[model samples]
Target chain A: MKKINLLFVLTLGLIFSLSNATFKTQGYQVGDTAIDFSLKNIDGKMVSLQDFAQAKGFVIIFTCNHCPYAIANEDRIIALNKKYAAKGFPVIAINPNDPVAYPDDSYDNMKKRAQEKGFNFPYLLDDTQDIAKTYGATKTPHVYLLDKNRVVKYIGAIDDSPKDAKKAKTSHLANAIDALLAGKTIAVSTTAAIGCGIKWKK
Target chain B: MKKTFFLALLLGLLAQGAHSQTIQTIKIKDLVSHLQKNDDTLRVVNLWATWCAPCVKELPYFEQAHQHFKNQKVKIILTAIEDELPKVQAFAQKRKLQSTLLFLDEDNANDWIPQIEKNWQGEIPVTLFVKQGKREFHSGDFTAEELMTQIEQRLNVSKE
Candidate 1:
């Protein structure tokens, strides 16, 4: 009986270790202080959250040129900047996709798309994919709203309806921003939306 | 007249073959029930979208698995998240997909995503494997060999 008990304990130890081996690190959560990045914008200039000294907060969106979901929210992102840039919370779009895997998301293509779409805000490139990995951005169009101190206020989708703006019942990002501006607690700090996965380099 | 009749018959047969796999639109509740069904079979539910390139790339692997495990108790379900039914139908037809296709019609992803898998960050090409109430969620694309290995492991487990 003692030998059997020992065998069972050994099996349990093996199972626990195997499960831990497969476990992944979830990078950041709401209320975590997000690290600032010095990524290059489309205009060949380095930009960072610290550079926006006048800003009260930021709408740091992890998006790209290739993902259809990102394309769908292009106008909405622009509108967010237009509406909130003067309000001290501007939009900072980041292309976190690997350029090698998706050439459409290359720095040159990003410039072209930004110019063509008349993007009012700075569209930066997460060339090394470090910022995205740190922020735990898994898909295109993932939003991480931060306060002036760079504390992550909200994380996830921009709105309930990601494909269509008219069908959006609740703008999670907008609502969070409004609550932050008013010094009220954000009703929903996180959300999820189906989107194209970020292509990591092989 | 005979030629025309034969042509019509051929077209009918072709249409039947083309539509052998039809896309069904279901709410999250329906999907949850299906997942919770008490059965000994291994269900490979892959959540994908038409616009996602990686999802499209990994679809053939699922189809291959379906073909290989057709006689076994293994079922492959290709579920589309936040996509239009017509587009999914057209894409399935174009690709000649053989696996069962499902259009997850629910739009509130934040609510349903956790229901499917608590850790799924709403990324496309994530696959869920269910067997005898036990479940395993894979959050990224899979190669053919990798998928086959997973299915084989699950099948062996069910036998035991």
Candidate 2:
């Protein structure tokens, strides 16, 4: 009877562990409360969503230096921060790529890129990639817009045209923010675009 | 005499161009139609781009699969999501890629990305395996062994 009980307990533990792994991989969905992360910023200071007390929301973008798609959207990311930071939704960029696989996406390079681009936002490093995993950011230039309460209002690409901003027909991220600020329902809360996959550490 | 020589040279150049594989530029609708085609052939559609390093690295695996499955009904299509034709053409020529090459000419990825796979978040190195009416979308890079195993498993599934 003791052996049977031990076996039953082990089996239950195994099932729970398996389910937990699945849940983590699925990451956040729209309306889900996003967990704040303390990632090291380019300025060598730790930053988190909770730090912005006065802000109405946050625009968290997972982007890297090596990706062409990310590079193309660099200007637009700056523009987003310039146009909306005062509106209470500031852009916070994160480099989630593994430095081992992509050396260009290393912390030092991220800092260099941020400085060169004259980023008007905080460029942070997800060294352990935990934040990216939790947010379910699969590719560079992936966006996750969260409300002041930390509820994820939007996820996916910044806009329709990732390669060329001039050719973009729709601004999904901006639209979601506008809707949220206006206290209206976001029509297109989620979108996807082609981008370089996040280089996971092997 | 000079005109004849120039004409001969032009013909030779044209013949050379014809011999080399040219990538066909296609719209999202064309791709959808291809995917919707009801056929026994297992269409292994690899969505990639020239600038994506991982995509470039894993391309040889698809090329090898294309060569290996030459006699079989397995079709390997390397669809590039690049706008510049010259770059894709040059890369294909330089690499000597043997798979069926195609260039997705659509700009609005948010519009057409869902058409390919609803859950796809527009990441490169994604592959779409289609046979009959069944479809399987695999995101991320694949090793040669893993690529072969996946193809073999799908082929076997189609047989049954």
Candidate 3:
């Protein structure tokens, strides 16, 4: 049965090809140097991590408008800037979602959201997602706390609670910032919290 | 004509009343216990949420795999954490998801994220394929063809 043999071979070949799925590398781990970028902010001006000359460090947040988790943290992000910007660890937010996939996160909508939220920090757009990729961002509401040297001192969720901000008992970002400000080692270098996966380009 | 119209309307309403999707909220301990040791069956647990776009996008792939590998010993279960019953149920019903669906009640993500996977950062759309107490974890979206391949690979590994 030559025909049967050929059919079997073809099926095997298909299985082999499928089994070889391509694996892409993930983003940076803790203790890694975070990459800097110049992405457009809601103000229509390009913003870079190096632009904040006076800051001792930064609270880089990879967030988007479409994600409910990000929406929940918007006010808290503003608060972080209000409290820390004056003390030098300003919040620098970047949206990494592809607007074509999530039209609500488009530049125009970003401008509107920033104004509506009264964002005290720079809400930049990661149009190419290069900065996000370099920093190893996997989802929205992801946070990376870095020193003035751009060294990522901490990474993960803002706090333990995502549903209700009031229920948050431990402020992870605040603790890390405080440690850096006090010139003490961060108590918790990394932590995980459930978040919306970044909407990557199709 | 009026009687026929009324009769048809009644039947439509009755048919609409019958819904099939089931959403359950269970403790993490129960979930861990459910991952029973099975040498022949491949259990695929997909962690997702209503707010996660990638998880929603990759659902069809799991569904297609379930249908295509009907004769194979494979089970696909979807677990959504953080989404309450109303939201999780609505999304499952709207998508007509055939795979088993669940909602995780344990909130303190810091406590559970590490328990599930030491390396996982609590991101949604994470899939775990388990066979014979061995697990293969994949984070992010997977195409249908790629999923099928991964299934076959896991199956083959377990056999050896």
lDDT of 1 by residue, B12-129 (tens): 9788667638788899998887687668889999998888888889999999999999999989999988788888888998888889888888877889998987766787878888
Model 1: which docking level applies? medium
Alpha-carbon shift of residue B44 in model 3 (angstroms): 1.1
Off by over 4 Å in 1: A1-25, B1-18
- Residue pairs in clash, model 2: A193-B122
Off by over 4 Å in 3: A1-25, B1-21, B34-38, B93-96, B152-160
Sort every candidate by DockQ, greatest first: 1, 3, 2
Expressed as tens digits, the lDDT of each residue in A1-202 for candidate 1 is: 9999999999999988646433344678998999998999999999989899999999999999998899999999999999999999999999999888789999999999999999999999998898998999989899999999999999999899898999999999999999999999999998988888888766
Question: What 10-residue stretch in candidate 1 chain A is worst by lDDT?
Answer: A17-26
Ranking by TM-score: 1, 2, 3
Clashing pairs in 1: none
lDDT of each: 0.88, 0.89, 0.84
Candidate 2 regions off by >4 Å?
A1-25, B1-20, B158-160
The clash count for each model shown is 0, 1, 1
Give me the TM-scores of chain B across the candidates: 0.87, 0.86, 0.82
Tens-digit lDDT track for model 2 on A27-88? 89999999999999999999998899999999999999999999999999999999999999
TM-score, model 2 to reference = 0.86
